[model samples]
Target chain A: MIGTFVVARRELSGLFMAPFTWIVLLVVLFINGLLFSSFLYQTQGNVTATLSESMTGPSFWLWMIFLPALLSMRLVAEESRSGTLEYLLTAPVSDAAVVLGKFLAATGFLALLWSSSLIYAVTLDYAGGPPDWPAVIGTWFGTILVSGLFVSIGMLASTSTSTPLLAAFLSMVSCLMWIAIPFLAANIMAYLVPLLTSTAAEQAVLAERMGSVVASMDALRHFSRSFQMGVLDTAEIVFFLTWISFFLFLTARSIEARRWRG
Target chain B: MIEVANLTRRYGALLAVDDLSFEIGRGEVVGFLGPNGAGKTTTIRILAGYLAATKAGRLVVAGHDVQRDSMGVRRSIGYLPESVPLYPELRVEEMMRFQGRLHRMDRQAMRVRIPEVLERVGVQDRGKQLVGTLSRGLKQRVGLAVALLPDPEVLILDEPTSGLDPIQRGEVRDLIHSLADDRTVLLSSHILAEVESVAPRVIILHEGQKVADGKPAELAASLGGGGHVAVEVMGAASAEDMSSLIGSLPGVESVATGERVGIHQSFEVRGEGDLREDIGALAMTQSWALRELSWQRPTLEQLFTRLVTGRGLDELAMPVASGPGAAPSSKPEAGPAGLSADAPVLASGLELSQGPTGPSALPLGTPGNAGSKIIYSLNPFDRGASRDLSKPVSVDAPPEAPAEGLPDGASEETES
Candidate 1:
């Protein structure tokens, strides 16, 4: 546990010290702030609708996808490139501790970046219309869960390569597939599966099964359906948590594999 | 403090560290010597717990089995890799503190030990500076400081003085000597002089196998011949006649002519024992003016060449620079004067290009020059062989050509 925190502290300090971090933060916040104000204006100051659209909207979702990659790319790739991974791994810390520490630091930084949205909550109170507190809280929780999964996936990508640019590009492509695959899977089941099945009854059953599976894997649907409207589902939270653990576990295994391969 | 037995590490079909075994007692400092691709770094990495051996037979360090208790081994050992890697963004003190925390040191203990280690490595004043901002030498000191943070019982340093200037190398060599007094240390270096000065026991590896292991003096003595005795005389006879007189001495094996200035000619005389007195007596009898007469002791450099290439310096004692039969490839038509003055280096280069011999002279395990060529063929990525082959030729080439030809040409240009 101490090893984890020590690694996390160093990683956090490193992230904060980089000029890229500030530039990303400045640009991301500036863009998200504009999108938030524009959404509120279009909705005529309707806090509940604006909060849902701003938090789970397409623009914000795209930022969540790439932001984690940008934040976690340097976590391992840069260290390995600089040859510092040898020193870090030779320490008394376990591979799991190193991986988990870096994951938590990146997730925490993303959460902090998201926290700038609290100004929207402040703006709601000051403009003579208080925001929907339960909706706001649920939206924030769903955002963190989604961002944590992205960060863990990005970390796994970071561990798979030594070049920071390659790691970032790999994680970005993986995140894109993660979101786009469900939609593609749905279209395949709806159109491509029917050509193979002769009976209408058989096609209906197969399409329903594929739809249920794809719907469950769709992260945006989970956020938009329940958490966006102040509904917290235990199964939704567990789904994201399970995927995060799976990726992080693979990351630790990749790090341990270098010892044998070298 | 360290023990390895039958430790074998393989990459695909290539064996980086072949079946090797050695032990270091508590408070003993051992030097690890090898040519390129000899598995020096691989062995050091395994002992430090950064690598795992394919067949880890009884590998132990600091009373812990490296395979079973790697954390314990890591905690008890301090390692400084050849390339000293540090976080450029972190302050020096912050780096120390982070390393301290990783070792599970308490706040009170870290408060005292961090500064103590900083002072020990002579970087006490640079604690507030960023690691990336410091020069290479200062960064190396910071690396040493981090390695010392745990006050480890076993220290493994690989090429500690690799990139330092002469004075800095001297300082680091002295520091390693001081640090070795009470702790068990395993140091690997390409610089034979540094190893000869610091380590009483040296283990030389050739082609991932242990070739020689003993004290430096003992290793040199086992070659069974005294070192060369250099003499300068101003005689009335011609240089060839004077060389013949020295070569005819009782114990003198051979004599190679050196630089001639006016009427004074220097001769390097090799023999069974010190031939200075014999040469001096002959010079006095012939009424020759003896300018200088000194007997040189056998060096670790000669021992290494003999063990690695199976060719002793005595075989390389021929006057290649002036001899008519010298290989054309051995001559560097355009090179620095310093390299042209290095006759033995040119001779070794000539010997390496000779390739392997048929089954005649010696068996496989012997220090035959055949073993080196075979080993070079075994690993295509062997940097040592390539470096040794090109090293002399590159030095012979214009110095600027190498700098511009390197892969990091852009960085060199920017630096200049």
Candidate 2:
């Protein structure tokens, strides 16, 4: 356990020390500031509705897709590229600790990025309007869960290669596919079942089955339905945690397999 | 502290280490001497628990099986890799503390040991400098400091002075010499002088297999009668009579006349071992004045060249264990089974050039020749009449045994 913390601490400090990190932070916050102003302008200063829209809207999903790639590209790829990974692996630490520690550091930094937007919440209170406390809390929790999922996928991608740029590209493509695939499957099923089935009743039955499968896999739908509406659903929480744990397990195994390949 | 048995590693049919076996006891500084692509780094990585060997192999470091208990093995040995990799983003002190934490050391102990280790490697002033900003030599020193942070029982350093300048290499060699006391050290180097200055025992690898294992002088003495014994005698007999008499000795192969000063004449007697004692005995019996009798030992460069080319193993008479199936068989006169027919080698192309016989040709007992030149310790086999005196002791001893009763005569004599 101490091995995990030691690695995490070094990785976190390394992230903070890089000028590129600060540059990314500044550009992201600047864009988020514009996003907050545009939402307030569109909603006529309805802070609660604006908060919900900002958390679940298309622009937010785009940021969620790209942010993790930037945060986690160097977690393992840079170490392997610079040859520091040998020193790290030869230390008295298990492969799991190294992978988990890097994942923790990236998730922690994602949480910090989301926390910086609380200034927008304070701005709403000072403007003679206040956000619904439960809804605001739910939105933060939902966004963090989504970011955690993306970061773990990025971590898995990072462990697959030694080039940081290639890792970032692979991570971005995987995140895009994760969000787009279920919706595409649902649309494809709806269109194909109508042409294949002879009777309307049979078509309806197959569509309902396909709908349930799409509903179960569509994480964005669950995030918008439960987390944006001031409700914390236990089923949704279990779903995100399971996927995160699955990816983290694969990342650990990938690191262990490198020794054999070498 | 380290034992490897039939250790083999293959990367898609390119065998990196081919059934290599050697044992290093506690408090022994053994040098791994080999050329590039000789699998020295691969073997060291396996011993350091960094890379996995084939399943048929077994390795133990500090009483822990490397494959079964890699964490224990890692904790007991400190490894400095060939590249000397470090986090360029970290400060030197931060790097030390981070490595210490990985070793599970307490904060208080780290606070004291960090600076002490830095001082030991001669990098105390660079604690506050960023690791990336330091020069290459300083970075190497910082890497050494990190390896020394845990104070491990065994130290495995691979090419520690590869990229450094001459002065820096000397300093690092000196540091290794000081740290070698009471610690089992296994260092790999392609530079002959670096290993010759520090390690008393050497294991030479050629094309990923053991070719020789013994003291530098012992390996030199096994170079198929390449060593020469220089003699200066004052007698009534002519130079040819003395030369023929010396050449008739049991192990003598040839004789070359050196500087002739009136009645006093010098002769270079080439032989299988040191023929100085035999010549002195002959002079005593023949009533000739024996003015000078010095054994000119072969340098390590000569032995390394001969062994790496695969020709020396055929003629190596010393019974150092060279193959995995070799036992402590006490066959002193038989050659090692290390040579294969397909080994790429030029067949014994060394022509015994008479004039330039290397640094060993510098005649001893001349004015100022005592301390100005470094005379490596006398070969143990040189003390006896033939090359087989020390072979029985080395061959009869168990290969995997500890350092309790191993040969230390050459190292001890050099110190005095």
Candidate 3:
């Protein structure tokens, strides 16, 4: 790990040096803050209820969808464009170390972004009757898991191309498709049962099975639910870590291929 | 120490480097000479471990295998690519420090090494300045300083003096020469003069293959005949008259006028041995008021052209007589005279016009003739003409020829 630290340090320092990172950070935080405040007003001082009812679900999803695009768009894309990738690859560092360092740096940045949303948590505590502290903490945890997953997907996309915009778009598309498959499958199952069945009983049986499958799929959507409830689930943590490691592995392979092609 | 054997790199269909092999001993400053697209950069990149060769080859750097132990090799070698990529926002000192950190150099070592390298490359004062803000020359110096960090055993620099002014180029050359005391330097450059002054041995790459490799003088003498002597006259004597007179002198095989004549007339005398004294005496006898008489050596440019273009000054000096007004008595010897045994004649086969034999026969197609004239050949092999002729050739006349009619024999007597 000394190699990992060196790569991570260079990447982190580069992020600070570039104006794009700060600009993205300010814009993201501004938008997130505005949304949070509007969410507060929509609740009309009932902060705890607002968060549990509507804010937690949508805000968690929003951060999941947007954070990855923001943090990972520059991971491999910027290095490739600036030609620093060559320097890093040629250094006395393994490709895995390079990829891990960059991934961790993006994850750290996402954590920082999540930390900025602590003000919303504070508002809920001060204004509302004793908030569901466990739920609030769970939501934060779920948001981290989801954001971490998205960051990995984004890094994979970034490694696929040298253009930041393309990487962001591809990452967003992949994330949307993964989440949207269950919804699409539900709709297809609903339409197909009416066409295939004659008797109401047969239709009922088919509908029940389809409902079960949809329920299982929906359970997958609750992958971050435990984190939202402030419960540390081994399975959920493993899922996020696994996702991060898988994409990082892919990014490392891409970099290794580049050394041969460089 | 570095060794590359059968190293070939292919980018899709384009072969960037093909079957290249060479070795650089420890502390040897070897200059890499090549024209544009000659694959010099590709070779250096492979050696630096920035690129992996497509076809497997044995590339060892400082006893570490580049393929198996690339990190070790990379740690031991420092590379400066053609375009020095620097973090624009980082100051020179910061960049150096960062590189040192990446190399895992201790803070104390960096504190001492950074300033020393900066001073050695003449960029000590610019350490606080942002790298992007520095001029190209200064940036090059900064790039050199960065590569000099960690005290790497090998330093690979590609086109180090590409955009520098004369003074800066000289400074860089001097710095490279001074560094030769401890480090092995492999530098690629298009500047022939700088390579000559700095590099003791040179490896020339042409179309991805190493065309020539040896000491600069050994390679030059091997490719072409011995050096020639160039005489610049400021008197009334025309280069045509001087060419004929010099051509007739013993030990002088051919006399060709260089680019600059009259106020800057240059006559190249090619032979097996030095003929400086003979030319000086001839100048004195003719009262030609010689402005400059110096031994002209074969430059890296000549060797490079001879390797890449397959032609040298000797081939370019061949007699060219086209339709009509061409004199029959002007044909000179067609074959090159003093070529080393191993030197390959670029355009060996096709024959040009032959001048009739006579005392008045002018060496037609000879590079620089009596008058301030340049002769062109239709053959693609005959090119790379130079006006600088500091090296002279002394010709030995046929033993039966009338000695009384020949000019001064002072220079010729010393030849053999």
**All candidates' TM-scores?**
0.83, 0.76, 0.77
TM-score of chain B as predicted in candidate 1: 0.73
Candidate 3 chain B, run of 10 with poorest lDDT? B343-352
Ranking by DockQ: 2, 1, 3
Candidate lDDT values, in order: 0.79, 0.77, 0.71
**Which prediction has more favorable lDDT, 1 or 2?**
1
Q: Comparing candidate 1 with candidate 3, which one achieves the higher DockQ? A: 1
Lowest-sum lDDT 10-residue window in model 1 chain B: B329-338
The digit string of per-residue lDDT tens for model 2 on A1-262 reads 8899999998899888899889988987888778878998999988887877766678778988888987888988998888898899999999889887888888888778877556677777787788887888887888888998999999899999999999999999999988996878877997899888999899999888888887787878778888888789898888888988999999988888777777
Error of 1 at B273 (Å): 3.9
Clashes of each: 1, 0, 38
Candidate 1 achieves a global lDDT of 0.79
Q: Quote the TM-score that chain A achieves in each candidate.
A: 0.95, 0.92, 0.80
State the displacement of the C-alpha of residue B178, model 2, in Å, after optimal TM-score superposition: 1.0
CAPRI grade of model 2: medium
- Chain A TM-score, prediction 2: 0.92
Residues forming the 10-long window of minimal summed lDDT in candidate 2 chain B: B344-353
**Can you tell me which runs of candidate 1 are displaced by over 4 Å?**
A190-198, B234-272, B317-416
Mark the 10 consecutive residues where model 2 chain A has the least summed lDDT.
A114-123
Q: Write the per-residue lDDT of candidate 3 for residues B335-355, one digit (tens) a residue.
A: 232221221111112111221
lDDT per residue for candidate 1 within B1-416, as digits (tens), equals 89899989997799999999999999999999988789999999988888888897789999999999999999999999888989999999999998999999999999999999999889999999999999888888899999989999999998888889988888888888888987999999888998898899999998899998999888877773556888887655545677888889998888876654333557888878888899999999987888899987778887788788898566554333343112222222111112322221222122123222222233445444243332242322122232123222221112222211233333223222
